[model samples]
Structures are given as C-alpha cells and as structure tokens.
Target: MKTIFFSFLFFGSLISAQNSLSFQAQLPSINLWTKIPDGPGPGGENIVSAKGSVTHVSIPKLIIHQPENPNGIAVLVISGGGYAHIESGSEGYPASEWLKSLGITAFELQYRLPEEGWATRSVPFQDAQRALRIIRKAAGKYKIDPNKIGVLGFSAGGHLAGYISSTFNTAYYKPQDDIDLISAQPNFTAMIYPVVSMLPPNNTTHSFKSLLGKDSDEKDQAKLSVEKQVNAQTPVTFLAQSEDDPISPVENSILMYQALKDHKIPAELHLFQSGGHGWGMGKKGTNTGEWTDLFLKWLKVNGIYNSDQ
Candidate 1:
C-alpha cells in the first residue's frame, strides 16, 4: 500500500475550512481522462443553485470532512440531482456532517453530470469508481480502515451508489494509476429514495434521460438498471424510502431490495409512511428524521461499524 500526503497549501483557493480536492489533483492522478472528455455535442458545467446544485461538471471533486475523533471508518457521500445536477448542500454536506458525529470520515463526491457533454454515458460511474479507489488508497493518510469504506447516496446519486456497489468489478474506465489497482468495491452501501429501475412503474424519467440520454432504448435501460445488475458480489445494502415519494417511486427501492435478497446479499429496507423524496438527512420532527439513528444502529448490528472502537 502506498501512502499519499497532500500539500493542502496548493489547493488553498479550492479548499474551504473543509478540504476539497479535485480528481485532477490526486498525487499519482486517478482521473478518468487527461481532461474533461467531450460528449456528443457542445456544453460546459454551470452552478445552478444557491445550495450548490451544479450541472455539466468538468472537475469532479471530493470534499473531505474529518471527524475530531477518528474511528477508522469512512463513507463516500454522493448527493442526488436526477443526474441533471448535484444537490451537495442538502444531501452531501449534511450527510457528511452527520457522519462526522459518529467519528466517521466523510468524502462528499461532486461527480460529473452525464447530461453534460461527456464522451460516454458511463462517465459518472467512472468518477464514482475512481473516488472509491482513491479513498481506499489513502486510507492510511486519513486514518481510516481501507476495508471499512462505504458509500451513501440519495435519489439519482443512490442509483449511482447502487451501480458502483453492484458493478464494482467492471472497469468503467481504463486504469489511470496505481490507485486504479485498489478495489473500488465499497464495504457496504446506503441509498435513500434511489432510482433503481429504468422500466415502467418505477422508472424516473428525468434521471433515466440524464444518464442514458434522451434517445436511449429500452434494451439500454434494462441493461443498466441497478436492480437488474445486482450479482453475488454486490455489497450488502441498506435502503430507505417513503411510500409517498412523488419523484422516484417507492418501488425503486423495493426492486433493489428484492434483487439483493435474491442474490443472498444482506440487505435492510426502511419504508416511511410519509416524508416524500429529497428530504436529505430528513426533517427533524418526523419518524423519517430518525433514519440516521436507524442507519447507525443497522451498521452496528451488521458488524460494519463499532462505536466502541
């Protein structure tokens, strides 16, 4: 295992009080391409919201949030935006903050938008896979257990987390460095209101169109759907969603849970009576708001986390 010590000064402009590192800035470079690879047509990234929702991302980044008391566990956080943009503020940052309370290090992913002009629709997957490898490769530096790294994603980002968890063995991009040699497979996965299927009754049209393109065929949809892609190697998973979620239907989570169980993968599902969708970290007064506690308990029960450590 190689140890990497980053010079935070070089990224002074990019780093806030919290650390932010671009994929392009990795020490040995685990970037997918030499530059932002072009897509079928013309376009560029843009920030669209005060909450830091962005589209057409050219520089995929990881925002690091370290706990004051390290517990040797880490989680890669991916926010959802239906593949159109990243909901970093609502999902990513808050998730990281919550994880920090447990002494778990968090790396919030600002992944590329497939809706942008990427050379392939798999660009987001490539970024996600690379991010996991980077986290594992830097385990020593971050004081994290390489084997304890997991992923938490919301909505479309949940689909992405599911994709990476189920398909980690598949190379989404050519190896770029030694980091690529590290396993991209997450130790476990947690998805909230994920867009799991591309077929009817559960298909999230916006996320589907953003990822597979407007002209994507049914075959393409079926092939890449996260639920359909689950295998024996898929990571143990924890899924939570609301029965009343108007956006990405509740059936999406059900389909994924079913697939995991069929493959004999250890999985947990939490269904809320209400809470709708996109309630990142959830609201404070509702039962859904207690999901963080539920997740922590689940982690301990699964032996994936040990607070006593």
Candidate 2:
C-alpha cells in the first residue's frame, strides 16, 4: 500500500513540473499604455477634442509551446483582430495547441495595435522581427532549430507576417536586446486570408490606411504590396483563403501565388468555395478546419516534417 501511494505522488509531481516548464517557455510580458489629451470642444474652426498617444507600449503576451520531440522547428503565430484587438480563441490558443499535437513548437505573438499610433508604420513590423530573434537566441535551451523556424499569421496579422517575409534584410530599428543580431527572416511562412495589396487599382483595405497614417502614394503603395515582393530567396509559402471572405478578398492570395510562381518559389494555394472570414479552425464539417491537414501535407512534402515516424 505504501509503495502505491509513493508512486502516485511521484507521478503527480512529475506532471506539475512539466506544466510549470511549459508556462515559463512562453513570451514575456511587457508594459503598454495609451495617452489621451484633455480637451472639450465642438468642431467648427479649430478643435482637437480627443488626441492620444501610446507610450511604453511594448509587445506582450507572447506564449510558446515546446514540442515533445525537441526538434529544431518552431512557428511564431500572429493573431488577428482587425488591427483593433486580438482574437485569443480563434487566432491564438487553438492554433498553438494544434501545433503542439503535431510535434511542432509554437509561439503566439501579441503585437501593438492601431490605437497606439497611426504615424508609425514600423513599430508592429519591428516587433515581429524581434520575436523571431528571441526564438533564435533560445534555440538550444528551448530545443528549437534555428534554421527551421517559421511564422504563421491570420487576417491583419497575416499582413505583418507577409511584411517580415519580404523585408527580412531591411533594418527598421536599432537592435537593443541580446536576440537582436539574429536574422528576422522566417524559414517559411503560412498566411491565412492575408491582405496583400494596398496600392491603387486594388486600394480597398482600410486597415492599411489606418496603420500607415495616410493613404499610400504610388511608390509607397507598391512597396507595401507583398505580391510584388516575392523572389527566389523568399521562404516556402502556403496560402489558404475562403472565396466568400468579405473583409479580405480571395484575389489577394491568387495574386501572391502568381508572384511566387513567377519567381519559382515553392508555393501552394488552397481556396475553399465557401468558408467566409474568421471561421478559424472552422465549425463542424466546415472547410477551414481541414486546412490543418493540407498544411501538414505540404510540410511533409517539403521535408520539414520529420519522417522518423
């Protein structure tokens, strides 16, 4: 009887230790705040009734999931909330848990939102880059492979992921942290219903204007379009979108796939006839949930998924 009691205690302690380790491996929290100016007036000649600024607003709530295999591959996840708020359920937790089940480590990134500032277009972009560097720095300790690290983003977060894929070499800000020296480029990118264009002829996404602080000019607009940025060196990409998505048009993925093809980059696009937007892992029998299987297939074909099984 004593032996059995000790055995139960040992197993219980082991489980508790594992849970503690998991929590410690996630993204660290940072200070963030928004400041609004004091005033009261009706607009007729001159009035700035409400003006605000975001200060000490650092990226927080990054959560990491370490895989059982301890292989080198890791994926950073960026959740989407229309650049306004983060959808923790659809865009964050479910995806992270699924990646863990597949023996793939995951990180959930919570970047700054538009309520912070409109004049600054590079803050959130810089945050994405920094997150990658942090992963690389702790590669060995976290059992992650630096070379196999990738990124996945949804909706507006997809736009940020797309930006990182294209401008990996661009230095947006000075590196201050220990992880700064590592490259920000993801080995591959998985974008779901991403917004790919902001230029005229296709200028429809208002989120871009709000983030950029002003409507993009011809040159700047062209620069923001990820479709035009694909190259031979760009990471392997997998794109999925619903044909009926009202917020992000399906054409965005189509155009990006064509660009990837032009550069001979490994790319796969899956467009469902009807899934609408933000179905997130999807409801029962919905098409969006099946995307996970398709993504895994792509990973296996690319040699990213280990075949030790």
Query: lDDT of all the models against the reference?
Result: 0.78, 0.68
Pairs that clash in candidate 2: 27-62, 72-145
* Span of 10 residues, lowest total lDDT, candidate 1: 1-10
lDDT of 2 by residue, 1-309 (tens): 343334333433343344322333354432211221111111122111111111223334356766677666788888666665555445555566668767888887766555554345566676787778877777887788788889988877787887788788888666565567778889989988888877655566655664654645778877878888887778999999999888889988898899889999899999988888875555343466667778878888888887772
lDDT (C-alpha) at residue 223 in model 2 = 82
* Residue range 160-194, candidate 1, lDDT tens digits: 99999988989787776787898999999999988
lDDT of 1: 0.78
List ranges where model 1 is wrong by over 4 Å. 1-48
Residue 123 lDDT in candidate 1: 79
- Return the TM-score for candidate 1, rounded to 2 decimals: 0.86
TM-score of 2: 0.79
